[model samples]
Target: MMGRLTIRDRSLLRDGVKAIVSGDVEHLKQIVLTMGVHSGRIDHARLYGDIDDFLAKYAKLDLGSMDLGQIIEELVGLAREHRISVPKGISMLSRGVLTLEGVLAVVSPKINLLEILANRMSAEIRKDFDWIEEQKGRFRNLYESSQKGIRIPAQMSDLLRMALKGQAKVNLEVIGSEQPLASLDRMVNRLVKCILCAAMLLGSCLLCTTGMQPKLLGIPLVGMLGFIAALLMGIWVLWDMHKHK
Candidate 1:
């Protein structure tokens, strides 16, 4: 018994025949539009010629299948029809025409312009990769320089934070007393400040007291005793602060 095919089966069969007849690109385009031809889908001007006079200019490009020149002329007409606004679209369509022409010449005159352009783009991509490697090398050098005790600029830290994933974060955590002052640092500063305050107050007291006892002030033993006491206290406080630091 013979069986009837479904709509999908018929469409697939038609697509297969179209592919064998036309080539890979046509088959692909047909498949892409199987659902429906979208509105304003094809630029008719790019597909056909719009003017008679302009056709003679590119008679050698084997454009027997496409009317790119006419398309350009029509796009120009579209510009005129739409005034200044149309001119913008006209310029863009003109460029599309040029690009299409370039694509067409990829296989003519015993040359492969497409492959050459591809190779050129490949070279450009490789150059970009090399540039990235050079930047990374410079970053490593800068990081090493900082490790060797060279002062890392504020910018370098920023760069590290931006580029490396976790390097800067770990470094920031491991480095001692970076931003928030440590407990020992705060303690040392507190002790030093206390010692300074004590010394200042004591000196002021001695000056005031000596003024009252001007006769006792001339006594070297008394002055020497006060100086020694201040010195010892300052030194002791400094030593404690240093130990805490």
Candidate 2:
């Protein structure tokens, strides 16, 4: 069930939760600032209940907690697994709590949520280092290889350009592939051509062949006619393929 929060409070909480989810440190700082400044003047019990209801309402997915004990446990667990430490914002319990740390209790399972998040943020740095090492290994292999080979296909280049342009759907009048990224591309093109060609061939054969009755499409003597007759007989095949495509 949803909590009985006022619209203004709900808006504040929604924005607050979004800031937490996005790990917006600056916004959290403001929340902490506002809360800390009013901490002494606020009704502590009511404020605590509000927090409890908020957690229960928000934590539909994760180890969402309504209690400080659960929040601490989750954070502690993450820390042990990832070898991460809590920030100074959460270190002093006697002090007014940091807004970011309050957000952390919801995001992380007690032990190392902050640490994991920090690691994720710096992943690009790690990726760059790893990429350099991999390139060095690739360079050494390329130089050592007996035969040097390279592939530069204009058709493939066009496809790559189309993909980068965010065209997930493609339609080609005719397909002529110099290079293929995957067998599926060739397979699809081949299937298309084969279907068209087969339809043509079937119609051609019906010219010499005679006396096959036209049942469904209501045409006269089937095999006596050419392409139209064959196509009429197997129009459903083309239709089904078209539907799937």
Q: What is the lDDT of residue 29 in candidate 1?
A: 34
Per-residue C-alpha lDDT of model 2 across residues 1-245, encoded as one tens digit per residue: 12244555444434544454555545533443342323133333334344444344435634232333334344333333333343333333213223445566578647444345435545744665777788999988987672444343665788899899997586673233323545577568657766775776666565444444563344333433545644564675566556756
Pairs of residues at least 3 apart in sequence or in different chains that clash in candidate 1: 45-71, 49-70, 50-70
Candidate 2: lDDT over CA atoms? Answer: 0.48
- How many clashing pairs in candidate 2? 14
Cα error, residue 15 of model 2, in Å, equals 34
Task: Report the number of the highest-lDDT candidate.
Answer: 1
- Model 1 TM-score, all chains together: 0.18
Candidate 1 per-residue lDDT, tens place, 58-153, comes to: 334432444443444543553344221322333454566466567666746444433453356557657767776889999999889877765557
User: With candidate 2 superimposed using the best TM-score fit, by how many Å does residue 219's alpha carbon deviate from the native?
Assistant: 4.4
Off by over 4 Å in 1: 1-185, 188-198, 201-211, 214-226
Q: Count clashing pairs, candidate 1.
A: 3
| TM-score of every prediction relative to native | 0.18, 0.18
Off by over 4 Å in 2: 1-205, 208-245
